[model samples]
Target: MVAAFNRFRLFHWLLAAFFLLAYLTGDGGELLHVWLGYGLIVLLALRVLLAPTKPRGFPSLAPARREWRKPTWAGVGKWLTFSTLVSVTLASVLGLGMVDNGEVVAAALPSVSIDVFGTRNWLGGLGDLENVHEFFANLALWMVGLHIAYILLFRSKSVMPMLRGLSPQGPGSAPKGRNHRQAPAWPALQVSSKVQETPDSCSFELTPPAGEAARFAGKPGQFLTLQVPCAEQPMARCYSLSRLPQPGQPLRITVKRVAGGRVSNWLVDNLQVGDSIQAMPPAGAFTLERTDADLLLLGAGSGITPLLAILQAALLHGEGQICLVYANRDEVSVIFAGELATLQQRYPQRLQVVHWLDRRDGQLNVPALVQAVQDWQQAECYICGPQPFSELAGQALADVAVPEQRIHRERYSGVEPAVAPPSPGRPSRVQVALNGQRHTLDVQPGEVLQDALDKAGLETPSACRSGVCAVCKCRVTVGSATMRSNQALSDRQVAQGWVLACQAEPDSAQLQVEY
Candidate 1:
């Protein structure tokens, strides 16, 4: 996601730089103008080749849009960008033609003789090439001015991406990890220990084998995507680290059986200590960082895992007024029940535990939860759980006028990617570039790029194939691919042609992606 933003920023600035230099230099700066001409031609060619894959940030030139009487601001901006690109390209071509005449540019700059192979065959050897070049060059200049003015008008919100290659999202949809792009590669680690938290719930502690424990540092509330061996194929599942990280601590993840969950069920029933599993380094953005604010952690089922970690970290730092509203089906189903009770007894003055049970409480209701927490609006609420539970909790907090920025959440799964419409039976030719090598593979129209890469014997780092982790994001340099959904990318990133390979499928016949 971020890669696309950087590409756009780089391409945009390069075009502007060349255009300005070429215009100021004119033929008087013959050598400068000549090189600028070459640069602009290359830049425009790349832009045009990649235009089809551009985001829907601007209005389409298609006849289909003619029927719509109203035009969007986005469409207007798109039209402006497209117009400038076209004008500049035409100007560059005309300039090259004028250069081929050699006599005109050479005369203007007496100090330098501009020499290049003459190709008068282009544009039917137009006699008014210089005039045509000047007209479009001036036209492009005006459009560039307008574009700069537009950017200035919305610089605070839009320009930051150009500078930092990042655009902020609403706090409700916080991106996963603290710049997870730099995270280490997945490492093979053996499970060191396992403990039964409750019936149907188990916690596995992973450590680097031998003296490699130094390689396994992780923060609380982060998660490791473990590659587990199944009977047929390997299954990847993300589980939150349930314990706070210490110098010598083993990374722990808690898993509870879900009725139809293949990964969770397999993990709870089959995973054992001493078994080996491949694990991506710990990464996630939903961790407790602000200690001054009163903390409220809301979670249900295994969602309590990360919240539990945050709670322990907060308590260790002596943060006061911390509250936990943990919900479950029954007391018997609660994970870490004993540890939570011990924590409550230890910090009876500052910590509060309110348990909601389906058997007695008839499901956790929003109004009741709000009522139970007297300082609900004052607390920074960290929530995790099933989709329905999270949605309910978020709405409840919002209903009470709690600031959206104060609420953080992590979803293990459930976001359907923003993908292309189904075109069943169609085949796509995908070219993948990874670690300086390129490979080609045929993907079914609806198949994700990662699957095709795997078939071609290439490894593309990924976690949470649903697109939340963003570890699989790759830049599409040619053709187009669409993500089914995205929580990782900013709008600017998507505009620049970044797609989550695990969640993206090609919409064009041939696509080129780089990792």
Candidate 2:
């Protein structure tokens, strides 16, 4: 029964992807016309055949805060999920009704009015059902508009894993530097040794199993979390996978020091041999969106993590025609410079590495960026950098005529917006659980949970304090906690009472949030 209900999730994502692609890049209207009708019948059939497995409860669509003290905001996510389901449901029902009357012939399906906008004349099987499908398709378009509108008003940086069919890390958790311990949910890449390659940069090679090379399983453009102990502060931080998913070979990540960052400073200054660290299984949606010969790899600061990984994967995968533009302040800050130079020397024909030095050249040369990507008209782009750098790269790609969708990006951490401190007058109480003990504190009303947790001298595990990452998720035992993250939670997870403590506040007096 549980498995059957899970199929709804699987089917929903697959169908959503299919329809999304169709609508975005195909003759979605006509396809949707037929697909909708089929979907309705399928939903019904599944309902009957998998009746025992269907969810017992239906979500309340009514815009009321009865269940929630604050309104459940369901702008784009709600609209997208609901509209896709509705569009497919309506079209499928109408199509089935027409098909049951022998109006649509399987043989005639191919020749039927495929262009929902092509011809009004619904010949043969397309008779009246075409009009009905058209209506639903238009309605679907409205839903799509509504979805976008909702996103515009209440857009979030973190997209939930459930909506996309993949479970992401939880949204919030303990503040920072609280002992967070979890064993390998997957075969973790063990660090054999942390060798000093250079004064500025170090090489972290994973310790393989049975003295074999350890290969991490993740996309070329995906990232993983590393948790090691530090004397000052100890918590895991996200690092881009710098190598493709190698089954048994060692995967590597290069890190440079950041001034005030606890983990970065610790790694560059105090890391040593025999010190093991905990790594969470891989997670992220910003994967190698796709591979194209005409590739543009951009990296600034540590944003180079995933881009370098993608480049390695491209080479290992036998990809050709690539150029990497690495921007840093100077040679002192250039990370993985040696490795990139070696790659350039080896694949001189297919790969080109351009180092943009802030000392010599002011910033990335706009014209050079344009020239680097001109060979392939239909090329895909992958970029990683700080917020400003990434935004600039996006604009540069657009200037070169690359479609918006073709340019993919990944960020381990980002610059946070200014957060106003919570008012001192109105303080609210929140309870957080660490290990097994629950600690409650009277937090300033609307004060960020992380801040409050810190004031109380409780160590909460965290990396990016921004609500985008799920380093702070805890299970809610008693009262509901509000999530301020842009990444919305799913109905099922919400019903299960999981909340991101970083983005949360105590909504109920007796609230309990636990890891």
Candidate 3:
């Protein structure tokens, strides 16, 4: 569900009411019909004119390319919306041209005359203007009827957004920071055990320090950001949890050594059992959206970490079929090969694992990927891998006509390029409102808003601080700010003053934000 502001809602209701009244008046009330048509034209013109300035108030009515490529009920609704807009505009224009005498409504308002194309003869035998006008009017009415039916049948939750300023099923409907509040800012956890999963990868079992077990809980597929103490400075890096999250069980994270990766190399070489490290609570948006639906899991190399978690959880709690397509360079580099084999043997009837080794199969191509998951095209799909592999899997799924909404992708690599560092200057002042409490602080140059709030003990919710996840979103209520990078926010959200606190930096002398 998507939320609509008050202005958009007003325009929506007024347009619907006026169109219905005008269509019903039909040849009986000429005066009322003409006036209603005039009102609609003005409303359409205003909507178009204000769209650039008020983006959130007037969403794009055009059907997206994906809607045309794939035929879903939601796509059909979008096409109907576009059709209705076109038909109504043509009807209004033809109606205006059909009006011959400039004095039709001049008696009521002597200063106004709406004779654009004067007489019906101006059409030059193309067709009767009144008939063409009536045809388009009826077509618009039909398209509107279909649109309403589509909403009531397939998108009932969408109606609330236009009726009120809130969407009952939207992500924003959840209480902000509720999940982050469950854990401390950074809790120390001791490594209980370590296992070499592959030649270059290892898994660590992290046990929460005494009295902090409850703060370490998380859903399957979530990740923990560990503060790695390198020689120069402590760097924060996120590692996916490798096993199902269960109470009283130690949290497990698998780290694969990457060439020139400082944090990954340090953890794989220097970290040992009994060593303690500061870790942020588990956070991510990659968790399963539905447990009952069959799942298609795709992964390559160490990207199998999160998918293993999801597969374990789904097999334990869900009664749905599962298919996993895992790719790796060869048998020696396949992480969790033994564990996957054991699980496949245990749940042979419900789970299927297909390993694609480049040594034998050559590189995984789009056609091969499509063939592997052809039977599960309708299942919920999750893809996690390097950027190239993820893109290939997504293209294969799209080729098979999977609905875009059902396919989720998580990139295991590619941190955005760093923004220019702030110049040396006096620190900026910041005022923050959180959970009904207010606090003031001075934010140093280049300091992120989320870091400042966390240092002040404000507990700002955040996941994927690079801006891929919008868990730390907040509104700028007073002054201006700029984001170093943003991949989660929509254009409408940006226009409405929403910013991702994890990437936001103060651009003025003073700034205020509410969470």
The per-residue C-alpha lDDT of model 3 at residue 408 equals: 75
Backbone clashes for every candidate come to 10, 18, 0
lDDT of 2 by residue, 1-515 (tens): 22333455556545644554454454436446346445545664565464333232222222222213432443235436555656756755554454322233333565554443333332335567768765886676676566656655665433343345443332122234445432223333556667554465566766534532322355676555666576454465666666666776655666666556767667767765555555654555565533324577878877777788888866654344787888888887777777888988887878888788888888675676676556544655777787678777777788878776566666434432345555445566566778779788876666766667777787665444545446566678876666655232333455688665667776655666677
Candidate 1 lDDT by residue in tens digits, 1-48: 344645665676676666667677655776677666777788666655
For residues 90-122, write the lDDT of model 3, one tens digit per residue: 887777677653556675677776553365445
Order the numbered candidates by lDDT, best leading: 3, 1, 2
lDDT winner, 2 or 3: 3
Clash pairs of candidate 1?
A: 59-75, 177-284, 177-285, 417-484, 417-485, 418-483, 418-484, 418-485, 419-483, 419-484
Model 3 regions lying over 4 Å from their true place: 1-184, 414-417, 420-471, 475-499, 504-514
Q: What TM-score would every model get versus the actual structure?
A: 0.55, 0.50, 0.56
TM-score quality measure for candidate 1: 0.55
Mark the regions of model 2 whose C-alpha exceeds 4 Å error after superposition: 1-190, 208-216, 318-320, 365-377, 412-420, 424-445, 449-501, 504-515
Which 10 successive residues of model 3 have the least lDDT summed? 167-176
